[model samples]
Each structure stands twice: as structure tokens, then as C-alpha cells.
Target: MNSTYANGTVHRYEEIKFVPPSNNHKTEVQSKDVTILPNKNVSARLYLSKISRKNKKFPLFFYIHGGGFCIESTFSSGYDSYLHKLTAQANVLVVSINYRLAPVHPIPAYYDDSWDVMNWDARGKEPWLKQHANFSRVFLAGDSAGANIANNIMVRASEESHFVLSLVGMALLDPYFGNGKPDVLWTYLCPKTNGIDDPRFNLAAHPKILSKLKCSKIFVFTAGKDNLRDRTWTYYETMKKIGWKGELGIKETEGEGHVFHM
Candidate 1:
């Protein structure tokens, strides 16, 4: 599908149509793209992959891709690589979600779509999840804007106890709002009215919701030069202050920008 840029230019954003290149560590795994109807006829593509194993039930890693909440797909090269690595190293089922974009759908639309997919998967209501996912050991992960969605999903799930997502680990890569001080470059690059501080995107507005997250291990990766460094740090601090019994891993890489997580 194509999208219209802020400059009123319509750009073609191609759907993920190619098989990812195979890696040395992983066997050519089973992969398929399926559509899930979250609300009425509104649907999003869910990319599911499995690494063959003998007896042990592997952990589940659900990943969300980053594109400033408006671009990219689950099959982007960087995300595809990351999933391959996670599967090779952890030997877990990796599922990447393609949420609805903004501008056309706007804030909360992405959140809603994410929540619907997550809830469906967590409840084993989705056929793919029932067949492939091992619910006992689960992890939530995301990068850039996708990191924001991952965090929000955890918060919402914990607050309402909507679905029993027994997530033991979480990995957030350079999480930030589009309007924070560090996000000045992003604002200049793609100016928009509703951003990080907006009530819709503001994580602070739902403190109660976030307080419910009780993960055992939280790993955060951020670059020193990234605009969202401060925000990511603050989030890390907040999670600790809220009594989250988890270990934090902050890697400060030099010369890496926002998309480095990819």
C-alpha cells in the first residue's frame, strides 16, 4: 500500500513480498503472512516464523517494527534480520506485528490495532498463536516508535489484566516521543502537531496503567547521540522506581542514530 507524505507527496510503500535471506545459524524456518481482523473488517498482517527444535518449548518473542508510527512493514530487512538472530540465539518463536499507520488512521489507531492483535494472540484465539506460540514463556520487544507501542501494550495489558500475558522479559530500543526535546531533529524533519507530549502519545497520562507491568527482566538499548536518549533513561528510571523487579541493560553505542536498533 502507498502513503501520502507530509509534503503532500504520495509515495508507494510496497508490501513485504520477498522471503528474507537465510542465515548461517538458522535453518530455513517456516514463515507465513496472515491477516487478522482486529475490528470489524479492519485487518493487519501478522508475520509468523518458527525455528525447529526437538523437545523443549521455546519462548515467544513478539516484535513490533518502527517507522515513526506511519511507515514500514513487519518484513523490513532490519526487523527480519533481528527476528532471525533472536530465533537462532534463543530458539524461540518470533512474531512481528504490522499495526495500522497514522495520518490516515492517526493516534490510538495503531494502539488499538496492536492491542487487538496482542490480545488475540495472548488468549490463543488466533489460529497462528494456538498452533505456533508457546505461551508459558513470552517476551515483548520493539524498536523506535514500535518500542513505544510495545511499552504501551504492556502497560495496558497489566492495568486491565485484559489478557494473561505472562511476559518475563522486555526489550525496548530507543523509545521516545516525537515531541520531546531530543526529538527536535525529528520534529524538524517531519513536523506534525500531535507528538510525544500529546495526550494520545503521552505515557505519563496513564501512570496507573504502566504501574501494572511486572516483568522480571527489562533490557533497554539506546545510543548516546539519539534524541530519545533522555526519554529512554527516564523510562528506565521510572520502571525501577515503580518497583519493577527486573534487570536493566543499557548499551550506549557511539555514532549510532535512532534507526540503529533496526
Candidate 2:
């Protein structure tokens, strides 16, 4: 499939095979193994790369990889490619997290770990942060289930005025929610449990939190064929109705399905 960007540049989707990170070697980007002490110790990892040192303060982009809250990790090449692209394009410090997964950790556990990492990063103020990671210009970007976690963090950050006071933008890649749709279809289609009413996956349940978020820019990318397409649009409309003064970029990828961004 092909899509034309605002710059009039045409881009085509090609099949790209990824090799998972091996124990023996590391990619060009150096990742540090760290455990977030959130209430209980949360097992997590951070991928770090310094883009530039000329600027005293650089923007930080926290990324959450998507896999239906069950199967993907920050080490996956699909996520690695996304991080590399962001590092080259934005000149910001990108950290991809491996939060605890579902069916084992369940709902709120993922949200908890995400918030924990955000808080951990907030307290540490990494050295690169002084030279490259901008504490005031942070952005949250994620895909699929990761997008759900990112949105939750944004809500929590706004509510508690925690670590994300500097959040200026958010990019949700195909967020999944029910939006009052028939549960039967969602249950039949999705491999995981289709508990659309679950606070983690349901956006309407957190209207107050969503309203409190002060993001100036929001980008939601969804494929026309995705079941979650309507939910993404609904959330965008909800943000507008709640008087969020932000620019929303809703791009519908033609002839693509869910997880197309990955």
C-alpha cells in the first residue's frame, strides 16, 4: 500500500523482516537494563541513544511497544526500527519500556508500571537529559496496546501532576477501544479477552482524566479497515468536545488493517 504525505512524498509499505535482538550482540543503540521500583519492583528496560549535545536541553520521547498486551517487547525489531527512526528524525532521547504483560499481570498493572517508569525518569533526570533530554518538551508516543498505556499515563499525569507536566504532544498509533460497539464482534475478532469495558481499554470510563490532560498536540493514526478505527475517531471527537485546544492529526491508512503502523 502507498500513502502520500503532506510534503507530496509518496511512501509505500514493503515487507520488512526483523531479526530479534540476540544475547551475544547489541544494536548500535545502547540499552541499559533497569528495574523500576513502582510500589513493587517492576521489571523493565531502557534503550538510550544520544542524538546531539549542542543543545543544553533536548526533548525526550517515551515509547511503548504494542502487542495486544500479551506478546511484544521493547527488544522487538519492529519497535527498534521505530525508535531508530525517531532518534534520527527528532534528535531526542527515546526510551522504550518492557512493562509487565497481561493474563499474568492483568489490568492496571501495565498502567502502574508505565506511571512508575515515568516517575522514575522524572526523579533520575538522566545526565543526557541536561544535554539532550529536554525535561520541558517531553512527548508520549505508542502503538496498539502501548497506545492505551500511553493515554492512561497522560491522564494520570494530568490528574496527579506527576512526571508528565512537560508532556507537549502525544501520538497514538491505532488505539483500541469499544466505544459502545457490539461486544460480540470484538470478542470474535480479537485473540485476547474482549473486555471493552475494562478501564485500560475503555476511554469513556476516564472522561475526567482525559479532560484534565493539557497536551497541545495529538496525533492518532488508524487504518480504514481496522476495527478500532471508529474508537480512535470517537476519542478525537471527545478531546475536541472537552475543549482540549490541540491539533489532532487523524490519518486513515487506506487498504490497511489494525497494527498497520507497526
Candidate 3:
């Protein structure tokens, strides 16, 4: 790994421009940004499918983006296109966070930003969530490093007695995890952690913490060809081992790689 983690790493490869929220997907979906954490310049875009808008209520799908916790934004061109597809198909009102990333910001900084957004909206501070979101149907979801944040937030929410918006489920998509090679990335992103053995990077390493996850319906999707497949599977198995009483599901698609859903 490079001794100079910030300027010389993958985290510095930022998008040149943030694509504005658009209803131009030519689909029956409307989207706009809502501020969650003003001090951090953190916010999320809300996408409402025609059905959801008409019905005036829908499942709350709060998404954390995957960018190795470094270079990507939910408003990036690729993610914007992908978000359109997700909103159109899921028929759910989706809120994707623009959480702070790593290298420039570092580990728990990324996690803190995400947790703040979730905790804020859940308290009814965000109008979109308060008016139309079904708190009972709330699901925390993400891909790759975003998925990592999703898991962490759920556990933290469970521990906070004041966090009343219950998370019903979580969809972890092609999560970037491991005990070896990816440790370099985690150390670079987190800096404060003790490498691969860190609970954040290796969920299986901490059964007690894994047991803290409160969602009842857990869904994990992994690409068969994804290098992180074994690590993702380990997380699922460990959740079961911890005696987590939930409906657990896993879908592995052969010949696919990381974040293929995008």
C-alpha cells in the first residue's frame, strides 16, 4: 500500500461533475434532492415511481452507495442511471445517500455521515420520509462498500433505544469484504482500524456484534465470479451462527462479478 494514502490512492479519482436529479429517465419516476446533514453537505436523492406517488405511500428504501468508500457519489452519471432502473423496477420510493467517503475523510467519518443521515430522517426531520415513507417497511440497502455501511448502521440503530424507525430488512449487494487482500483497502479507508481482523471488514470475526443486527428479513446477493464471494457468504453464515432469528436469503449468480446489478 502507498504510504501516502490520500493523494496517491483510488479515493482521489472523483467524478468531474455531479449529474443533477432528473425525471428525464423517460420513466414514471420523479426525483429530487433533500438535505439530511447540512453541516456535512450530505444529502440524498428521493425517487418516487408513479405508483408510489399515486398511492401516497411506499416502502422506504434507503440506499448507501458503493464507491470503495472513496470516489463515487450517488449522483454520479453511472449511479444516476442505475438508480432510475432500480426505482422503476422496485416500485418503491428510494432515498440514496451521498455519504462522505475515505482517504480525504477516512473510516468512521464515512460511517458517521451515513448514520447521521439515517438517524435524522428517521426522526421525521426529512419531509419526504415523514410524509410518504412507511417506517415499518424501511429497508437499508447498498452495494460493495455501501453495503458495509448498511450493515453497520442497522446494528447501531438497534443499540440506540431512541432510534424508533425500525429497519424491517436489508439487501446487501455484492459487498466488498475479506480477511486478506481487501484489508489493504480497509486500512487505507479506515486508518484507525487494526487491519483485516477489524470487525468492520470481517463481520464473521465478531459474532456478538453480528448478533446486534436487528432486521428481520435479510437478503444477500452475490455474484459467483465476484472475488469477494467467500467473504460475503461468510457474513451470511456468521449471521446465522449468531442465532439471529430472521428470514435469511442468499442469491448467487454464476459468471457474474462485483456489483453486477449496476
Candidate 4:
């Protein structure tokens, strides 16, 4: 997606390809959109597996969709399909955030909605969540740029005491962390950012930050053939070097490239 920014506004010159969210007919997973901001028509997609026990609550899977802080959405077919299968197989209630995109809203705008969703007392706000979601076992998962958002949320949660949810773990699938250099897409979305070395994009620069993650465990997945592979490795090594108290799991797919599993 190509974009031009000027005077606090951005214009995109390309037509982005997108597929609307839909439930797979063959799967037992059912999904629906829930309103987040009725005035703005902002919403999120919720996925539940029909095979689940009638009265038992399942772990909550709060997911953020990846599109480089620009394109894609929770309503996109790719994400919808993946979350459907994931909800069914993992036996978790999937709450996929559909944050505002860039070329209009920009970086922190996307992050803000995600942070709000993460902090929402869902059990008190939504009936389905109250009945079906086990908030005590909340897990945050995302791929690529979404993973970046997930990590930033974790870091921010580490520094704040007001977060309401208890996160058991976080899963980062081919996170989009960058090396020590300016990134075009990132700099575009975060115009005032201090380049790619900003703590949001470069966790290695802030070694102690990893130790303060609010979660008890973390799982990071990387594709060996991905361009961002080394950056993920750097992040993993930094976590180890900091002697982070949380349990850590790292996995790499030898012949794949960025988010291949998705």
C-alpha cells in the first residue's frame, strides 16, 4: 500500500485488497461483530467454537490483526478463517480487535484501541464474554505488525498498574520488530517517533523492559527464511540476557517466511 502524508493527513494511492469476514461453513466455529464505538461504527470480531461445553468457560484469546499498522482488519477473511480454526482447536474464546488503520488514523491510534480492548472488563461489559470467557487465563496473540502491538501492550502494562485483566501468556508470531535503522512504514505511521530505535519497535534497546512484562509466560514464533527473523532472534536473546522471570518458548520454522502458518 502506497501513501503520502501532508499537514497531518495522509492519502493512499493504491486500492487495498480486502475480503469481508465470514464463518467457514465446514467449521463448527461461529462468529459475529461486536460494537466497540457505536458513534464511529468501530467494532471487533468474536469467534466461539460450537463444540465447547455448555456451561464451561474457556480461555480468552485476545488477538490483534497484522497489517503494518495500515491495512488489513479483524474483519478480513484471512484473519476470520484463522481465528475460527484457532478458536475451535484451542477451545478458546477469540476476541479479534479491528483497530483503525493508518493513512488516516496512524500508529498510536491503532495501538490505543487495542490497549482499550485488552483492559476492558469484558465479563462486566459483555454477556457472551461473561458466560464463555475465562478472563483469568487471558492470552494475547498476534502476527507480524500485530505482534508488535501485542509486545508494546505488554511493555506498557508492565509500567502501569491500572490494567484490569490478568494475562497468562503472550504469543508473538513472526513479530515485526526492526533492526537499528529508520523504517519507512513505521516512520510514516509514527511521524514523531525517534526512528526505529523507539522502544515500541526495538525492545533490544531497552533490555530491562522485557523483565517487567506483566505476563507469566511468553511464546515467540519466527520463520527462518523471513527478513525479520534476525530481529526476532535479537529480541529472544535480549529476553534471555535480561534474566526475565517469565517462562519463555521460542520456535522457528526452517523453510518458511513471515507468518507462514497463518
- Give lDDT per model, in order: 0.66, 0.69, 0.80, 0.81
Clashing pairs in 1: none
Error of model 2, residue 74, in angstroms: 0.6
lDDT of 4 at 60: 87
Q: Among these predicted structures, which one has the highest lDDT?
A: 4
Across 125-214, the per-residue lDDT of candidate 1 in tens digits comes to: 666567767787888888888888888777676667546778787888887543344454344333454554553355554445456676
TM-score of 1: 0.77
> What are the models' TM-scores?
0.77, 0.77, 0.90, 0.91
After TM-score superposition, the amount by which residue 164's alpha carbon in candidate 3 deviates from its true location, in angstroms, is: 1.2
- Model 4 per-residue lDDT at 93: 84
Q: What is the alpha-carbon lDDT of model 4 when measured against the actual structure?
A: 0.81
Least accurate 10 contiguous residues by lDDT in model 3: 1-10
Evaluate model 1: give its lDDT.
Answer: 0.66
User: Order of candidates by lDDT, top first?
Assistant: 4, 3, 2, 1
Which 10-residue span in candidate 1 carries the lowest summed lDDT?
40-49
lDDT of 4 by residue, 162-221 (tens): 666778899999999977866777787787988889888988998877778979999999
Question: For model 2, what is the alpha-carbon lDDT of residue 1?
Answer: 36
lDDT of 2 by residue, 1-262 (tens): 3444678564545443544532213334544555566545564444455433456455778888877666677766787666665665565667677787554555667788888788778765655444556678889988887898898888777667445448999999998665865664334333364466555566765566577777788898899899788889888877777776677778889999998756
Best by TM-score: 4
